[model samples]
Structures are given as C-alpha cells and as structure tokens.
Target: MGKGGEDYGKSEKVGFEFRDKIFPAWAKDVKECEENFQVSHEVGLSTSEVQKRLGIHGYNELEKHEGVSTLKLILDQFSDTLVRILLAAAIVSFVLAWLDGQEGGEMEITAFVEPLVIFLILIVNAIVGIWQESNAEKALEALKEIQSEHATVLRDGRKVRNLPAKELVPGDIVELRVGDKVPADMRVLSLVSSTLRVEQGSLTGESEAVSKTVRAVPEDTDIQGKKCMVFAGTTVVNGSCVCLVTQTGMKTEIGMVHSQIHEASQNEEDTPLKKKLNQFGELLTMIIGVVCALVWIINVKYFLTWEYVDGWPENFKFSFEKCTYYFEIAVALAVAAIPEGLPAVITTCLALGTRKMAQKNAIVRKLPSVETLGCTTVICSDKTGTLTTNQMAVSKLVAMGLRPGTLRSFNVEGTTYNPFDGKIEDWPVGQMDSNLQMIGKIAAVCNDAEVEKSENHYVASGMPTEAALKVLVEKMGFPGGVNSQSSSDHESILRIFPHPWISFYFSCIFFYKP
Candidate 1:
C-alpha cells in the first residue's frame, strides 16, 4: 500500500519492487544492499527513521484474518442442500396446517407436530456444529500465540536488546544469535563464526540446519537455494550473524505462505464425501418430485363428480375444491419422503470424531473437514518438523579401547534433548566405562553447542549434531555438566575448519592436557 507514495522515488527503499520492476536483495552485495536500504552494519536505522518506516511498512507479522463470526457459523450449519430442502418443506407444512385450522374454525395444535419436529432436528444440528467449530477456532488461536515476541537490533550505533519484534521494520540491522528466531526476511551481511547455520525446518522442511553465506546469489534462486538470505520464523542454530532487514510483515516469505494458505482456504474444493452427499440430495429431490406428481395425477379421479346421464366422455364433472383437497395428500407424501434426521446424525458423528482428534492435539475447524481428512488415502507430507521432533538425540554410544581388537559398545537412552532423563543401557551411568567416559569428555570439550535448563525442560542451541554430543557428555555425568560456558579445560585452538556442506563435519585441532 505504501508503494507509489513520496518514498517511491527514493533509491533507498527496502522492498523488492522498484516502480514496475523487482530488485532482489539476495542478488546484491553488502555495499549495494546497504545503499539500497539505507542501512549500515555499525550504525543501524535511527530511531526517528525506524519509526517512519514502521508507519509505512506496518508490523513485522503476517496478517491474520478475523475468526469465524457466530452468525456465520450458525448459518453455515444450514447451508447443505438437503437441509435447505427440508427447511422449505417444514415451512410449507406449517403454513398449510394453520390454513386448515383457520378454515375449520378450530385450533389444531397437534397438526403442526411434523414441522415442529423437523425444526427441532435442524436446530440441534446447528448447535452441535457451532460448538465444535468455535472450540476449534479457539484452539487454533492459542497455537498462533506461540511466536517470538522480541528481537535484538542495532540502532544508532548502539545495540538495543529486547526490542518488540513487531516494531522491526525494513532497513533495520538485526543481530541473530543461537536460539533466536529471525524477525523478518534479511540479507546476510556478516557471519561471526566459521559456521553460521539457520534451522529452517519450520520454513523449508529441511531436517538439517542450512549454512548461510554473506556472498550474493543469483536473482532467480529458489527459496531453498538462496544461501545468502534468512527468512522470518526460522531460528539460528549454530553461529551468530548480522543481517539487514529487507522485508517484513506480509512481504516476508513466511507471510507469503500464510497468505497463500488463507487464500486457498477461501476457495476450498468440496471433499469426496460432501460431493457424494450433494449428488444424493439432488437425486433424492428429483425422485420425490416425480413421485409426488404421480400421486397427484392418480388421485385426480377421486375429485370428479358423477352425472345421472352416463356417456363415454361427458358423464363426469371436475370439482376444483375436491381436486385441491387431494393436493394436501401429495404434500404430506413429499414431507414423509424427506430424511429430516440425516443431517443431525451426520453432524453428531463428525463431532465425535472432532473430539477424538482434539485429544491428540488436532483441531478441526469444520465438521466436513473431518470427513475430508478421512477420505485421504495417501498423504505427501514434510517429515522434518511435522512427523519428527527436529531435535537430535544420542541413542547409542560406542568407544574404541586401547587395543585394536578391544571395543566397548553402550546404548544411550532418551530420544529427547533432556540429558538427565535416561541413562546408558538403562544402567545408573554413575560408574560409566572408562573408555566411554573419556570419549564423553572429549565430546564435551571439543563441542561448541550449549544446553541449558529452561523452566521444566532443556533447550539446545547450536548445531543439532553438536547439541546431541553435548547431551551425551552430560548424560554420562561428566564434570561440570555441559552448559553454554563449557569449554576445553587446558587446550588452545590451533586451527578449525567447519565443513557444513557436503561432508557435514567440523574439523578442529586443539592442544589439550593429558
């Protein structure tokens, strides 16, 4: 919306669009990106300029549509074709009963029983639908609340810690460290360590962390191939990096995904079950129409009056009142053919399914969605963050002995990041094998990952492989259990080579005490 404004002509605009063309940040180097966004590595956007950009770019978050309204939910329950047909039949029957009673000059309360029962069934179905859907909406809203609330940004030559992430705008310099979530899409300016990797499993479905580079990439690179960029909603795993914010809010990659999901949801296709039900409803309506017409035509003979003179074609007279009387019977027959309880039965079954899924932490926004999922035969899904926990755990540990033929193998317990939960081979681990202890000590010393206890659980930061090693050392009860400050006792770094690409290994040479 801010495009074509006074800032449209400014060369320092942060968006990818420039008039009628697109200028990608990943295709430009640090100097060009700095000039284009008016950002710097040392002194970031000033407070006043940041405020002005915030007013233009809006918050650094995806747009969330309002939840389903109560009225809409209620109306949606009656949107089925069969339900609409039944509703019409009920109204007509009620009107006919009232007219009959008025013409007879008497109150006929019991004559309205059929229509009242149909209306009651419809109301019950609507209530069940609204209740289940509303609960699902609330559950989804709760899940959306889990997000990064603050960010660290460089402003006016000083580091501002704990700045609200939503206030972050384009052109701001963001400093990302281990375990910190990226606040917006940014172009990497510099990496503080030899390996700066971002955990993009949530964004790109990559199980392993992606190594980032400061070099510019091709403009047409796909999202997964853009090695020079980090997107919002991803976390820094291994090393620190200074990046320039290029896009925020709905302009970011995650924001775009969110928009696509919202758009797709609006035009969702009918599921197999829904389509079948609709077809059956149409067929049933047609059959009922033909049957009712046949009943009226066959019963028309009862409406004819007989004359004293008998002839081939002039012996009978048509009576309009008698003919209309038999029409009520046809209407009754049509109402009887309607399946008034089908909707209620279907809704109740779906609600039960919704309850079972909710117990497993799944929410179904619509009752029909339950059937839609049941209709799935094979699902192609990203396994990294969806099917797996995305955390590395040490399941087995083996160490070579002093002799070539001598070897000791041990099974490490626990599949989570918690170091103290499980022991080696279900043993106490208090008296670990000497070889295992030595290997654990080496793993604890040479690793760069950090594990800390947060509240009730342990949180790992850095490469998952290194984190797993750190957890193993701590699980073996190494001295000074692994933490962020764990380092070599008496060693000096001589050389280090972090090959995180093809080899997926980190080689380091250290001089350590015996």
Candidate 2:
C-alpha cells in the first residue's frame, strides 16, 4: 500500500535505471520493489543477469584507496619546511669547501666532512619515520577485516550456500541467519520465523537490537526507523530472513562512511610539533643569513685590497684570494649556526613514543600523532564497546523457595558465554529443587538467543542478556537446551507472551495445560 492508505503500482523507471536513481527502497512494497529490479519472489536472478549486474555495479567490497608509494613516502620525509632549509645550507657549505680546495690547487678531504655528516643525519630521520608509518598501516588493515566473508544467495530457484560476499550484486536474494553479518544493504522481503531482529550497533551506535519487518514505511522515515531494511556491516541477532540486495560497493551506507574517512585521513593537517619546528627553523635561518652578511661586510672593508688594475672596467680591483677566504668563513659560520642534529633528535623522540604506545596495544599511524595524544586531556567516545566489554554473561542468580519467606542465592561460575567452563556455586544440594527447576524452565523457554558450538568454542547470536539467560538454562540441563527444541513445544507451553521486545527489566512466561 502507498502512503495515506492509497494503492501503489510499479515504478515508472524499471531495472538498472531505477537502481542508481535517488529512490528509497523502504518506501516501496516488497512486490513493487521486486518488479523494479526484474526479480521474482520464488526464483531470484538468473546466472547471466547476475553477471551482467556485477559488471555494471561492481563488487560488494569497499573501495580501497591507493596507498602511498615507497618513493613518495621517502620524498615526503623531506617535505618539512625545516628539513628544506637545512638542505640549502648543506649545499652552500659543500660548494664553499670545493672552491677553497680549487684555490689551493689540491683537494682537501677534511673540508667536505661537515656537509656529509648533515646529509647522513637527515637520511636516518627519514628512515625511522617511514618504518613506523608502514607498520601502523598494516595494523589498521588487519582490524578492518571484521566484515563477513561469505553469504547464502538464492539463484535460479535454488539456494547457493557459502558464496563469497564480494561477488554479490544488486537484485540478488540473500538469506541471513542469527550470528551472520549482513552482506549488503537490502530490503526485507519475508521471514521464516515469528520475529526478525538485527544488531546495528556498529552502524547506528544503538545498544538494543532493532526489529525488522517486510512492510513499507513512509518516505521521510529516518535510517534508524526504517524497519523494512537492513544495512551492510550489521549483524542478524534473532531470527532468519531473506532480503533483496538493493545497493553494493561504495553505494552502500557503510561504504559511504569509509569513503569519507579515507578522504579525511589523506587530507590530515600537520601536528603541533611540526608547526612549531617549522617556525623555529625559519626564524633561525633569518638570523644566520643576517650574521653571514655582517661577516662579509666587515671582511670587505678591512682585509680586501682596493688596488686599480688596467684590464678591469671599474677603477677598484679587489684581492681574489682575500675575497674567497671571507666567503668561505661566512659559509662555515652559517652552517655552524644551524643545529644539524636537531631534526634527528626530534624524530628519534617521536619514534620512541610510538613504540611505547604500541606496547600498550594502541597503534600510532604517524610519529607526530603520539604527541597529539599526549596533549589530550579528555576523550569523548561511545561507551558500548570502547569503555566496556560488549559481551554479556550471567554472574549471579537469586530465586524464591517454596516457603513463605525463603530465598536462595546461587552464583554462576564463568564470565563468558561458554556453558561448560564453570559450575554454579552454593546449590540447594538436591536433584534440582522445585523452585530452581521452575526458574531454569522459565529461563530456557522465554529466551530467544541461540548459543551453540561452532568449532571448538560456543558463540551467541542474540541480545547479550538473553544469551546469558540461555547459558544459565543450559548449565541447569533444561530439555533440549534452547535451539534444539521444536517450535511446537514452545507454542504449547508458552501460551502468553514470554519475551519482551522493547524492555528487559522483567519477563513473564505463562505455562498452560488443557
């Protein structure tokens, strides 16, 4: 149905034309959306059509901007204003030394030592900066590999399992189960369970899982309120659903965010330490230039001769030997005034700071960024995963006994979702007393989370609180755990609503017998 309870038909534009249009998928009904994409509810796109769309839309993976080349990284090390000034000074010193040797009619090896030492210091600093930056980039790339690698797609009226996520294209049908990462941004078509929910905290920063539906919503609905759609990079937490892929690659919302972040990092400004060093270098160069000019003037006035020569156009003739001596002295003075070791010392200090941060599990991409972090006094961050562990497990349980005012407290053993690691402490010392047995049954029947063994470890696929409750039920040996039981058994015993979708402060499970 359309907005305001009106009937809606297929879009004016069909197929790939509507794919790149500024259209919102959540505003259209499932049938109309399928029609626009030229797909069917039962059978998905054919092999030929899937390949064609893949060529047009590209892969579902995010675009990786090209990294800095080795030559460019080395050149960038000398791009600092201070380093440029020092380079000019070193060239002048080398030329003066060469001229002095030419006047003496023999090459002097010791005169060229100053320039070589300055060049050596600068090279060492550049090497340290390049090594630290490359290591940090590798660490960041490893962290970005948390997305799903494979997905289940529907093609040619049959299910294709374990298909790589990068091969998915627009109009493809994808089946998502609990604990599965969403492969692409897709519109919900239908669900096989009573309720379907997704954990979008990585995308939306919401701690609660969002309930999904197949019904169309208003066009002006915000991203968080779009119940008819699921985005890429999110995870399915509760039930299974089949969705139609609408966007892939850089067209998806998460891809857009990655593009923005990449652009920001490329255009990052210089750190405070770099700015201060540039200003200091400029000021020092000005001072050295003034001093060199003064020395030359004093030498010209007192030491050089002003004898007249016949071949010269001008009347005065200066002593060539005395002039060359003063020029050499001026170059030496300027080179001495500038500290060639300062740049290397600064680079070494920043490198040391980066190493300390790495030891503490904090990666530093740039050397100057270490100082930037040291200047930080307050940090505002999302509390869900940054400040606390995102996983939840039961720690303690309290139940009321059959007597009027009797209460018993039992401590759950482990802090993880694994059920076999620890045992409950301070039990009632019987074959599961009446009160504890009822509590265990209620915990198992009411929870919607599924905790099962994948390989060697157990993983959970629902709300953390509910997952903790399911683990508790398993430890108490409830019938068939949670996921092993049939849906018919749950429907018969759980007549009233047991799980609360919105609030979780309290839960009620009703058991009925006819």
Candidate 3:
C-alpha cells in the first residue's frame, strides 16, 4: 500500500468527481487512457477494483425517469381547461337539483340527466388517454429489453465473463463481434482483424458501416471523425475488435444526447393543434356566457312588463316564483349552449385516428399529434430509397497490375444482387494476366458473405458493397455458385482491413491450411 492505495482511498471519498478530475478519455490515446485509469488492457480490472470503480461511477445505464402512474395519468386528463369547465357546470347542476328537491317541489329525473352525462364523458375520455399512454410506455420498455442486455468482458486476469451491460465499469476490456451491439463508449486498443467495422446508423444516421482503427485520432476531432472510437448503441457489422471501455452509462456521448432530449421534452410547449383547440374553447365559453346572460335579462324584463293574451302574448306579473323560474331557465340555457358531448367525440376520433396510423406502421405518441399532422404544410424526408429504388450494380470495373498502368478493364451489366443475371463483355482475354486473376480472387475469398437462391433470384446475407463485389466476380466468367471454389476458400480469410472513411477499399490477408 503506497501511492496506489492512497489513490484508491481518495476515490472512495464523497464529493470526488471523476470526470472533472481527469482528462477526457476520448481525447487521449489508448495507452494514456489505460495508464490514467490504472487498468491493464490485457487482464482488465481486478474483482476488487471493479467493485470500487462501480461505487465511484454509478451504474452503466441511462437515467430512467419514473413513468407516470395510471391514476395520475387519468387525473391529468381532467386537468384540461374545457374538462374543468364541464366539471364545474356539472356540480352546479347537481346543487340546483338538490335545492329543488329540498323546496318540496316534484323532482324531475331530467334535472340530473345533463350532470350524469357530463360525468360519464369525463370518465371515458380519461380512461382512453391513460390506456394509450401506458401501452406506449410498455412498448418502449420491451424494445429496451430486446437490445443489449449483457456484455463480454475480461476480468480477474485472464477470465472472460458475460456481465450485464449495466454493471460494466470503465477500463474493462470488452470484446465486440459482428452483430453485437457496443455496450459502452470504448477506445480501440487492438483488433484480431485488420479492419473492424461498426454500423453507426443509430448515432450518425449513415447507411454505410464505418471502419474503426487502433490509432489515436486528433484530440479535437468531431464525433463522426473519431475513427478510433466506437460509441454505445451502434452495432458491429463486420470483423471484431478488443476495446477498452472509456465511458459508460450517462457519461457516454449517446447518453449526453439522450439527456439533451429529456431536457428538451421537459421544456416542451403545447403542440399547434392543442394551442388552437384551447383558444377555441376559451372563445366559445365566453360567447356562451354572454348569450345566456342576455337571454336571462330579456326574459326578466318581458315577464315583469306586460300581460299575456291566450298562449301567444309575452306579458306576465312580477313575483318571486317568476324570478326563480327565469333564473332556472337561464342556467338551463347556459348548460345547453355548451357542447358537453364535443370533448368525448373529439377524443374518440383522435384515438381512432391514432389506431389507424399505427396499423399503417406510423406510431402517433399523442392524440393531438394526429391533428398536428393534418395541419402540416411542409414535410421534409430523407432521400434514401423511400421514394425510389436503391438497386445497385457494377457498371464498370478497371483492374490494374502492381508494375504499371491498367492491365485490363471490362464493362459489367447488372441491375441488382441477382448474380446469375449479370454479364461482362469485351474482355481482353489474352491479357487476363495473373494480377487480374488475383484481384478477382481477393474480391471473392476475402469476403465473409454468401449468395443463395431465393425463389427466382439470388439474395446476399452480408454488406451490400461486398455483395456487389461477389456479383462482379461471378460476371467475370468465374464459377458464380454460392458454394463456388472461391467462396469455399473464403473460410480461410485471415484478416480484413476496410477503409470506409478514406478509400472505401478493403485489404485482406488470406491463409489456406488444408
């Protein structure tokens, strides 16, 4: 116990901010990061060290905001201004009916009908809103479960273990392979393959897989330019790498963006449709109140002024009973003017529209979003095959030898991944040298992909770019079968180095040990 022991003791103290005290791990080289964090890239952290780091870094997960309870969501539905006004009207109506009964007059059943209807509408609307919100939250939770749950990590010298991603701490050496989601932000330490590729679509929205490198990039490199780093949530699409965990949980770059989203949602204003509906409700309420007041005043004046002839005349005698009757009539007029059923109808319609949108593969998170979409005038969209075909084929190929210029070039004709349908013509067969043949062999053997017959055509199961290359090899008069000799030899691919950001070419080393 010397300097190392003192550092460990200080790490255990309260109010120690690890991030503020150390240089950003992403900006540092792999060796520098390992030294600063006191971790071994080969053996990772010891069991005791992992526990101590967990205590200091918290869990390796995003901050989960507690979901709104069902009861609370239901109560929130009634908090709308229009709903509150209806509730107040209902209460007034019930009190008036009770006063009538206490005065010894015959209690009409119709006197309670409006209040009962209002109450029913309020309850139904609240139930629908609560159900929709709860289902959406549950679906989101299910998706999170289906993603990455456990990570393969090195611990306690040479032992490898599959631990929950949430339990992963910084400085852990994690292994990534094709189809595996990166569990945390990591710096590429070393790789078994010459090139490891990851699909950063979740973070960068790019359709192509990005290549990763062990070399440290510039300290001021932008997120997309950091070729040495692999972020959490992106999937490893090709090859494999052993990376040192630099950041985990909310400290990662993806986590920072997630935190920004949460903050923006907290400060979200009302949607356009919601704002318009509220303004309409306020205006309608004022208009109804004014109309009701005018009617009541005119009725009182008419009743007190003249006498009635038969049933057509309007004149009547002034009395307390007449005044009470006129007041009751005014209250009834105000209640009738309000469209009590309007809220129920609107809610039901919006809910139906939401269900329809979901059926069409478009999910509407909120009811008002349905109306908002209807009012939208300008819609922006990505131009990637959403409106057209993204079918790709090799239009031309130029092969060159190591000695000088072009050895032989050919024009290829194809329209998709269907390998059997394409052809190459005008080839200088006399000049089909060993270098050109080697290029074709490299294109075929270095790839870890296969094409299979699906009904009437061929479909590939790997990267589209690699699949296109395989088609090229087939059109070059080589055996184009899925189990062709070249493809069979692909099993001996020793390493692949893909240049995604720089040259878009892959260099490979092959070994055939039979």
lDDT on C-alpha atoms for all candidate structures: 0.78, 0.77, 0.71
TM-scores for all candidates: the values are 0.76, 0.73, 0.69
Best of the candidates, TM-score: 1
Between which residue pairs do clashes occur in model 3? 306-315
Clashing pairs in 1: none
Q: Clash pairs of candidate 2?
A: none
Which runs in model 2 stand beyond 4 Å of their true positions?
A: 1-20, 91-117, 139-146, 301-303, 308-325, 352-365, 370-381, 386-389, 393-462, 466-498, 502-514
Q: Please, what are the lDDT tens digits per residue for candidate 1 over residues 117-138?
A: 9999999999998998888777
Candidate 2 on 243-285: residue-level lDDT in tens?
9998776666676666656776788888888888889988988
Off by over 4 Å in 1: 1-14, 17-21, 89-120, 135-147, 293-332, 348-365, 370-382, 386-389, 399-408, 412-424, 433-461, 467-514
Ranking by lDDT: 1, 2, 3
Worst-scoring 10-residue span by lDDT in model 3: 1-10
Query: lDDT per residue, candidate 3, 438-499, as tens digits?
Result: 76777777676556687866765446677788787776655444346655754565666666
